[model samples]
Target: MNMDTKSLLIDTSTILFQQKGYKSVGLNEILKACNVTKGALYHHFPNGKEELLITCLHSLNEVIITDIEAIFSRHLSTKEATISMIDTLIHQFEKDGTITGYTFSSIVSEMATMSEPVRNACGALYENIQNIYCKKLQADGFSNESATSIALFMTASIEGAMMLCLTQKSADPLKTIASLLPNLLNSLQ
Candidate 1:
């Protein structure tokens, strides 16, 4: 088939999987939503749903890493970059009214245990995100050890905040984290 057909399948499947957990969304729904025949889907993804989900996760990982790197590039300090990234997230969460299916939490919660390949994709996504923060911190004069530790802490903190924001239906959690990051990072330095 063409690029558009393949993209339509991936894009539609990603949204369905994100909005509903992996177990909740069926391949038929994706096919129906995209108006593509099952034959077409199987042609693009021989392994079916598992392969599609893994591909979606990998694509999301690349997009997220690139966006995070861009955010870091625009800031001079790790604190600024961290806060800016969180702020951007908060804005998106507020605008979207619910977390988009793009986050690792959505995919991880549903399929991480059921599929090894998908779990590995989620793990890589988390690791790449953390590495972005680590590299930024290192550039701001933090040592390798400290940067790694801080990156882990920052990622966990922000991810947790995002979950809270989703459950609470407000961005208060993220805003609070953003407000406090400056003092917290300052103390680290």
Candidate 2:
């Protein structure tokens, strides 16, 4: 496979999988979307769709961590950083009509029971994202337990808000989360 071919496959597959859950997206759809052929796909991903998705999950994890780190770096506190992150997501949802990046929740809800590799990949993705928040909160002087708790809470809250935003075809859920975030973070402090 060529240098761009593998990257193209992973990028295309991530979008399709993010839009449609793991079980809903097929290899043919990914191949067609990427304009990549079966031979090239298999050449790049010998284990096929599952391997490709696992790769996508890992790639997405890196992207999300980098984005969160950037957001955290820009603010003086985790509270401000997190609200900004969610606010950014709200804008993305409004502009793109969906969350542009980030996966795991949809795939995990759909494939966690069926595929071990997919489940593990999704688990790692969430863990890495949560760690970024946890570390940021710790740096801002929250105790480890409080930071861990808030990190998990924020992850769950944001993901649920995203799903609700998708389901309602509105950004209100995320907006509400952003509005409530300051209070939520302050309560723990």
Candidate 3:
């Protein structure tokens, strides 16, 4: 039950933070959203909102890293795996009926400047994601330098595409990126 409450808090806080930035979400809001009392929240996150934010970021990061690992594990070529990843993201956005950008983007934009811990957590998450892409590219025969460079470019492009899609309230940006990413990666090869 302790784990359940902590998970609930993380989940609820994730949604709230994603929707309303870190600075805007209060303990009361999280408590109401999770249906947990102050003591329970404090019990799980003794450091309060900052702790909760860091925990939520880490949780979301782990989930994405796991998903990326699963995608790469399918033995697909780097190009195919990347396409699959974009398609999966598109499907999720379509299903959820919202394109709020990536979770890290939301938090980093709001809190990275103000909190060192938040900045570090966000930095690690981004690096992990880039590493996933780098490994895939390297496995596909790209050199270390090339793979690392391309991974950074690919990650940045996708993040930009996500932001564009979210801002435009349409999947066209992502779809276009998905269509073009294969060719772009191939060009690097």
Which candidate gets the maximum TM-score versus the true structure? Answer: 1
lDDT of 2 by residue, 10-50 (tens): 88888888878878998889888888889999999999988
Determine the C-alpha RMSD for candidate 3 after optimal superposition of all C-alphas: 2.0
Q: For candidate 3, what is the lDDT?
A: 0.83
| Candidate numbers sorted by TM-score from highest down | 1, 2, 3
State in Å the error of residue 155, model 3. 0.7
Better of 1 and 2 by TM-score: 1
Q: 119 in model 2: Cα distance from truth in Å?
A: 1.4
Q: Model 3, 1-189: lDDT tens per residue? A: 455998999988998988778899889999998888999999988999999999998888888788888987785687888888888878878887565434478655755465788888888887998998899888899999999999888888888878777778777888998899888887879
Global local distance difference test of model 2? 0.84
Off by over 4 Å in 1: 1-3
How does candidate 3 fare on TM-score?
A: 0.91
Give Cα-based local distance difference scores for all models. 0.84, 0.84, 0.83
Q: What's the residue-level lDDT of 26 in candidate 2?
A: 85
Residue pairs of candidate 3 with colliding backbone atoms: none
**True lDDT of residue 33, candidate 1:** 95
Ranking 1 against 3 by lDDT, winner: 1
User: How many clashing residue pairs appear in each of the predictions shown?
Assistant: 0, 0, 0
